[model samples]
Target: MSDTHLLICGNSFNDVDRDRLSTAYPAVYVDAPADMAALESGLRASMRAVAFKGHTPFGAEAMDLFPQLGLIANYGVGYDAIDVGAASARGIAVTNTPDVLSDDVADLAVALMITQARTMIRGHAHVASGRWATEGEIPLNRKVSGSTVGIVGLGRIGREIADRLAAFKMDIHYTSRSEKETPGWTYHNDVVSLAGAVDFLVVALVGGPDTKGQVSREAIAALGPRGVVVNISRGSTIDEGALLDALEAGNIAGAALDVFENEPNPDPRFLKLSNVVLQPHQGSGTVETRTAMAELQLANVAAFLEGRDLLTQVN
Candidate 1:
């Protein structure tokens, strides 16, 4: 057996991938864990860098169990669920597939804008529930063209969204950590002011402790009654309760969400509202994107085994 033992705390590994792992390391796969305790037990017994599927979190305590863990190759781009600082403290490198998912996520963001703006959900519910005739012609939803679009956290995905929206003749404005010098776009130093400035506030920021509650109640309120909020980023970036309250009060026009704080199990309260559009974190769920993500993850693992630097190290 190879000295580099590998363990995966996630869904079924690709059969080909599993067979490949068997060639080099003692690969283990666990599914539908009852609790973290079971996962902890598995990690403690393993002496290798562990891979996690979905949103399995590897915090300080979890990291402590694997002394020989050289790296954590997370399955997704966002490391919100993982404790990067904790992993670094233990001299473990954390890698995420970032650029691979940016365009996919940006596509979802624009799709959200189109879906919510066109009231696609309202029309769909009408037809599905057999109430289309009774509803008597679905009302017109908001328009996307030539609208002021404000992007929060103007990173790779945000920039992509901006580029796509420009084709619609929409005015672009953004708020980031610092002012970016992109030509033909307005930059706002204050997110609250930026929220108030645009017809649609599109969120494409990363989610983690730092970005937790970044979109505050005050910011949401600033968006005004006619403003639409679109979140293609992590849900933790927005205050869920505050968002619900804004939707209830009609403070903001509507929202299109592709991700949530409690994913796979989003707040049930959001489902009750017709003004909100929800997607099950499928921003990067495309076959092409997912395959790319897995390939990158495998490359990261292979590089580590060869004593090479990670392709997309989070640190």
Candidate 2:
């Protein structure tokens, strides 16, 4: 029997990525955190590292199951699903694949902003469904170029998004822990002010307790019915209830979301709206970025197993 030192948790891994990890280490695979408890005592004891890849909560209880777990190598940039405090308390290191996916996520955010602003989906449908030929012409939508955009977080991904929009001649405004050194870009101390100042608000804040609902009802209201929101970050960073309310009542212009509070099955109310642009959480879904993420995750797993320094250790 192969050694079970590495356990691959979560069902989101593609076949190639799974094969790469399993080939690199003696591994066991489980679909979710709950399945870890079903393994035999000896096997659980053998798990030294976990390559986690899903949004499922891997908390203290789940960590306790693997008594020998030394590392939790999360697959994506956001390690919000894993309980870092619990892992730290248990002497387990945590690593995440961050910068590799930043460009892809940033690209998606920009694409979403442009798509919603210009109504690309509707335009495509108009041509594909023969509506343009029959009805004469589709309505002209808003232009993205030369518009004002506010980025909620000036992190790696956030900066990338701002840089892309800046190329389009946009006036960039951002809010972060502290002001960055970028010249000409306005810095807001609060999200409400940021939303009020820009035509498009992009959320790139990290997901965690500190940031949950950081974009509140007041912030959404401050957008003043002319602003659009583009979120490529985790669903927890924004107040989904407030965003939905704004969309439904036309309090804000619309939203282009790559993440949601309840994913795979978002709120049914979103289905009824035509202004919103919804995505299936595919921020880093490109083949190149995902392959890079998997490689980073595997590198972290190997580093932990071989007693080397972790590449992107968070805790």
Tell me, by lDDT, which candidate is best.
2
TM-score against truth, every candidate: 0.90, 0.98
Candidate 1's residue-wise lDDT over 1-315, tens digit each? 344367666664566545555465666665522233464454555556666665655678766766678888887888777888888888999888889988899899998998898998788888999888776778777788999999999998899999999999999999998888889999998779999899899998888889888888999999999988899888889988999899988988899998888878988888888888889888988889888887788888889877987899988
How does candidate 2 fare on TM-score?
Answer: 0.98
Model 2 gets an lDDT of: 0.93
Off by over 4 Å in 2: none
lDDT of 2 by residue, 124-209 (tens): 99999998988987777898899899999999999999999999999999999999999999999999999999999999999989
Model 2 C-alpha RMSD vs. true structure (Å) is 1.0
Report the error of model 1 at residue 207, Å. 1.0
RMSD of each: 2.8, 1.0
Once model 2 is optimally superposed onto the true structure by TM-score, how far is the C-alpha of residue 203 displaced, in angstroms? 0.3
Each candidate: what lDDT? 0.82, 0.93
